[model samples]
Every structure is written in structure tokens, then in C-alpha cells.
Target: MKTSDFHYDLPQELIAQAPLPERSASRLLHVPPGDACFADLHVRDLPSLLRAGDLLVFNDTKVIPARLFGAKATGGRVEILIERLLPGNEARAQLGVSKPPQPGSRIALDAGGEAEVLARFDDGFWQLRFQVEGPLEAWLQHAGQLPLPPYIERRPDAADAERYQTVFARETGAVAAPTAGLHFDEPLLAALRERGVQTGHVTLHVGAGTFQPVRVDDVHNHRMHSEWINVGAELVSQVRRTRAAGGRVIAVGTTVVRALESALVDGELRPFAGDTSIFIFPGYRIRSIDALMTNFHLPESTLLMLVSAFAGKQRMFAAYEHAVRERYRFFSYGDAMLLWPGEGESGSGDLR
Candidate 1:
């Protein structure tokens, strides 16, 4: 399919610049497969909408402070977005500057430290060695700022530091927050538990490549960036039990979908702990995730393609049209949508 197929018109005003006052206060759009009808709801309605046997899988990957502003030795400005943190106080990051720094040149960090540009990779990221006190994580905790999505117009503030993170966040590796999980709060989790809706967690360290755009017209030519994912045995057992008990596996975000689907071995879901560059588009045979609950995505984005794959291309397009018409918020801090798998335009409302 062509990348242009996923394009849609979104008003700039509809793009949420900041999060709502409450985590569960954002709007929710429920689109059942194959119909023109959809329900307008809120994030707090999730527990009531789901059945007792339904399992809601959440991505607990914590968003780290990856954005660091610094100045070059030549007095030029530089911005570093840590894509991956390695051992030895080293990192691979997307270095932003008018003129790229030379190898061995140090950039003065705003975090009271400096990093040397060791080398540049073919992927356009620079290998950097930091001269900081204590561990890199500790240093970042005291100095780095939260990395907001590119769609956000303003700079991150105190609210973003807490709002960008989920209540269940534990693992600290992701550069971007899984926007879908941002809707959940401790009270909502308690409500889900009270409703007998089971919950599980997976970790997928989202990289800065999540913001990368598709440049090719033919989507088949596009290659997805690999991100680290971890699926423990507990989650595997939960999935098996959910299936055996006739429950639905509702993936909270696309990240969980990738992690669970990538863990499939010999047609069975197994524990996985590694990196995955799995790309899901139209015509993909999805073996995991009975439903998806996620925020609205950008026009012609890989995320939109994923939802189109999970639902149907036409179905998703129709939903986007409806969302725009209804003045629904768009992007990272935007409203959410719940979708069930169905045939594109041709089939009835039976969820696969």
C-alpha cells in the first residue's frame, strides 16, 4: 500500500498542546468494525466497557529524560536526544546542530557535564561519551528534561514530567511515552480490577525513531527501527490463561502488540526479551490482540498504519474522518480510540 493512503486532514487547533487536568478526562472514541456508527466516551468508561474476562495488557515502559541541550566548543548550539544508553557512560543520540560536531570535540552540557562526539553512525545518530559524575541514569535524573513529541509546540514543564508517564511505569529506558497508557490512573486501574478486568504489563523501550516519518510512497519499502522489548513468563502465563478462560486479549497500545506478536514462536506466544523492528501494515495476519485502545495518531504515520492493519484501512479512515468532524483532539496528548478487528468495508460487524 502507498503511504499516502493513510493521510488525513487534522486541524492544527485539534492537536492537543498540553494534557488535560485529569488523566482520565480525555475523550474516547469507540469504533466497532464495519459500521458507520461509533460511540463517544471518556477514558474513565474503559472499565465499564470491558467485560470481566477481558485482559487489558499495558506497556509499562517508562519515558526517560532523554532531551539534553548543550553548546558546542565552537560556541554553536547543540541538542542531543538520547536514542539508546549503553554501558561505560556512553550513548547513541540524534545530535541536532547547524554544523555537526567533529569526533573528539566536546559539547558543554547544561547538566553540569560534557559529552564527546566520538563518531557518527550511518543511521544519522552520534556516539557520545559523557563526562559526568556517578551513573548516567543518576546524572540524567538531576539534569535532563522530558522529551515531548515533536507535535507539541511548547516546551515541557513540571506537568509533563508526571503526565507523560503512566501510573504503572517501572522500567526506565524509553525515550517516548506510550501515549495510550497515559490515560490510565491509579483509580482507573482499581476500577478495572474491581470490574474483574485483568491487567498485565510489558516493557518496550520506545526510541526517538518513533517520531521518524515515512519518506517512501510504497509502504513495503519502509523499514521499521528496532526497539528493545521484554515479555516476561508471567505475561505469557496470563495470556495462556486468558485464552483458556475464553477472555479477550485487549492490547493497551501498539507497543504491547509488537512485543506480544513478536514473541510468537511456532504459532505460540512465548516469553521474549530483545529488540524488534516488526512492522505491521495492511494485509498483515494479526495473531495477537483482540482489540486496541490507543490515542489518535498523526497523518501518514506508522502508528496509523498499524491501527489500519488491526482494524481496516477504510474503517480507520472513516473513523479519522468522524473524529475530525466531531472535533476530537489529535496526537500524543489527544483523545483515544477503541477498535475491534474487522474486514475493511466489505465485511459485517463480526470482530475477528
Candidate 2:
């Protein structure tokens, strides 16, 4: 499919700038399989839409304060967004400056300490070694700012430090949050458990590349950036058990979908811990998830393609049109969708 096939015009005002005061207060667009019409609903109604024995797999990757401001030894200003933390206080990051810094250049961090540019990659990431006194995570907690998505168009405030992360977030490494999971809170989770709905977790450290636009016209030509993932044996067994008991394995976010799908080897869901660059488009068969709960994605983005692959392209387009007409919020701090696999896909139909 062409990358342009996923394009949808979203009104600028509809892009959510701030999170709702309540996490589960966001809207939920329910897109069922086949010819069924879409249903407008609220995120709080999720428990009623799901079955007792069904499993909801969430991405527990925690968003970190990955954005930092610093200056080059030459006194040039620089902004850094850490893409991935490396061993020995080193990291791969994207740099924003008037000019790219060359190797061996030292940057004096605004929060204190320094970082030496060690190398650059063809894909726009730079390798830097930090000179912090303690653990890099600790230093970032004290000095770094929350890396909000570019679309937000606002500086990080005190509220964002808590609102941007999910209630289940624990494993820390992500530069961006698994936004679909952001709709879940303690009360809603308790409600789901009371309904006998099982829960599991997969960690996929979401990277800044998640926001990268699809540059290729041919969707197949696009390459996804690698993100670290860990799909543990317990979750794999939970999925199997859910299947055996005639229940769906619903993914809470695209990140969880990617992690679970990447762990599928030889037609079996296996435990996996590694970096994955898997690109899922319309033609790609998804064997991992029965349903998906995700936020609205940018036009022509890899995330849109992934959803188009799960749900039908035409259905997704129609759904987007409806969402726009209804003024549903979009992006990271936006409303969400609960989508079952399209007709002829790997999952059951009309889960409700």
C-alpha cells in the first residue's frame, strides 16, 4: 500500500494539547469488524465492552525525562532528546541546534555535568558519553525535562510529569509514553479485575522515532526504528491460557502489539527480549493481538499503517472521518479507539 493511503486531514484545533483532568475520561471510538457501524463511547465504558476471561495486555514502559538543554564548548545552544540509553553513561540521541556538533565536542549541560559527542549515525542520532556524578537516570530525574511530543506545542509543566505516564508504568526507559495505556487508571483497572478480566504486561521502551513521519510513498519501503522490547514467558502463557479458555487477547497500545507480535516465532508466542524494527502495514498478518486499544495517529505515520493493517484500511479511513466530524481529540494526550481485527484477519469478530 502507498503511504498516502493512510492520510487523513485532522483539524489543527483537535490535536490534544493537554491531558484531560481524568485519565479514563477520554472518549473511546469502538470499531467492530465486518460491516458493523462504529459506536461512540467513553473510555470508562471499556469494562462493559470486554468479556470476563479476556486478557488486556498493556505496555508498562515508563516515560523518562529525556529532553535536556545544554551548550557546546563553543557556547552554541543545543537541545537533546535521548533515543536510547546505552551502557557506561552513554546514549544515542537526537540533537537540535543551529549546526550539528562534531565528534569530540563537549556540551555543558544546563542542569550541570557535560556530555562528549562520540559519534553520529546516518539516521540522525548522535552518540554521547555523559560526565554525570551518579547514575544517568538519577541525573536526568533532577535535571532533564519531560519530552513532550512536538505537536503539543507547550513547555513541560509540573502536571505533565505525572499525567504523561500511565498508572502501571514501572520499567523505565521510554522517551515517549505508550499513550493507549495512559487511559487506564487504578480504579478502572480494579473495575476490570472485578469483572474477571485478566491483565498482563509487556514492556516496549517507546522511542522518539515513534513520532517520525513515513517518508516513503510506497509503504513497504519504509523502515521502522528499533525499540527494545521484553515479552516475558508469563505473558506468553497468559495469552495461551486465554485462547484455550475462549477469550480475546486485547492489546492496550500499539507498543504492546509490537512487543507481542515481535515475540511470535514459528507461529508460537515465545518469550523474547531484544530490539525490534518490525514494520506492520496493510499486508502484514498480525497473529499476536485479537483487538487493539490505541490513540489516534498522525496521517501517513507508521502507527497509522499498523492500525490500518489490523483494521481494514477503508474502515480506518471512515473511522477517522467520523472521529474528525465528531471532534474527537487526537494524538498523545488524545482520545482512544477500541478496534477489533478486520474481516479475514486473525481475530474474532464483533467482540461485544
How close is every model to the real structure, measured as TM-score?
Answer: 0.96, 0.97
Runs off by more than 4 Å, candidate 2:
345-352
Best by lDDT: 2
Question: Candidate 1, residues 31-70: lDDT per residue as tens digits?
Answer: 8877758999999998877998899999998988999999
Off by over 4 Å in 1: 344-352
lDDT of 2 by residue, 276-297 (tens): 9888777677888899999999
Top TM-score hit: 2
Model 1 local distance difference test score: 0.89
